[model samples]
Target: MLYRVSVSFHKNYLTIKNDSIEIGIMEKPVKGKANAVIVKQIAKHLGVSKSKVRIIAGEKSQDKIIEVMS
Candidate 1:
């Protein structure tokens, strides 16, 4: 599955809305810390391994494209 994810820093939560996902991450975007948490959170939510979820685009921006392999 592919998703367009919008990231925000408020709380730790992930919400799936249609083809988009709204993510509220607690970790700061430092040295990929927030990205790591995003991957982990998505993987956990989908009941998949961390390796299965990947950020295909926008690694340095608030909006990201994510690809998930089953």
Candidate 2:
């Protein structure tokens, strides 16, 4: 099971590692790769499980609509 998430990614990663990927955004758009970090942060703040958040759409756009499910 999975869920869709929408967010903007900015460079928050201090160092590149295989196991750890960092992403962050300020209330606005930032230039960076849209990865799991952003999704995780949003999900956590939303009080939802990480597994419930996934990037189902809008790979290169700002306005993204995510589907929430059980």
Candidate 3:
């Protein structure tokens, strides 16, 4: 499955709205911390492992496209 997520960093909470997954990360978007958090959260949300989740695009942007392998 593939998902397009709109990430909002530094938010108070995480939210899932419609087809988009919103994540809140305390860590800044430095050293791929936010990206790692995004992958982890998505994997948890979909009941999958982190290795099964990958960011195929927009690694350095707020909008990201992720691929989830089942």
Best by lDDT: 1
Report the alpha-carbon TM-score of model 1 versus the true structure.
0.96
Cα lDDT tens digits, model 2, 2-70, are 333334344342222342323345434444344445565656655788777666666566544444344
**What tens-digit string does per-residue lDDT give for candidate 3 at 1-70?**
7778888866745677666676777778998988998888888878999999999999999889889899
Which of 2 and 3 is the better model by TM-score? 3
Give one digit per residue, the lDDT tens place, for model 1 in 1-70. 8999999997878899898999999999999999999999999999999999999999999999999999
| lDDT at residue 16 of model 2 (Cα atoms) | 20
Clashes of each: 0, 0, 0
TM-score, one value per model: 0.96, 0.45, 0.85
Collision pairs in model 3:
none
Better of 1 and 3 by TM-score: 1
Q: What's every prediction's RMSD, in angstroms?
A: 0.7, 10.4, 1.5
lDDT values for all models: 0.96, 0.48, 0.83
Q: Which parts of model 2 are misplaced by more than 4 Å?
A: 1-33
lDDT ranking from best candidate downward: 1, 3, 2
Badly placed stretches (over 4 Å) of model 1 are none
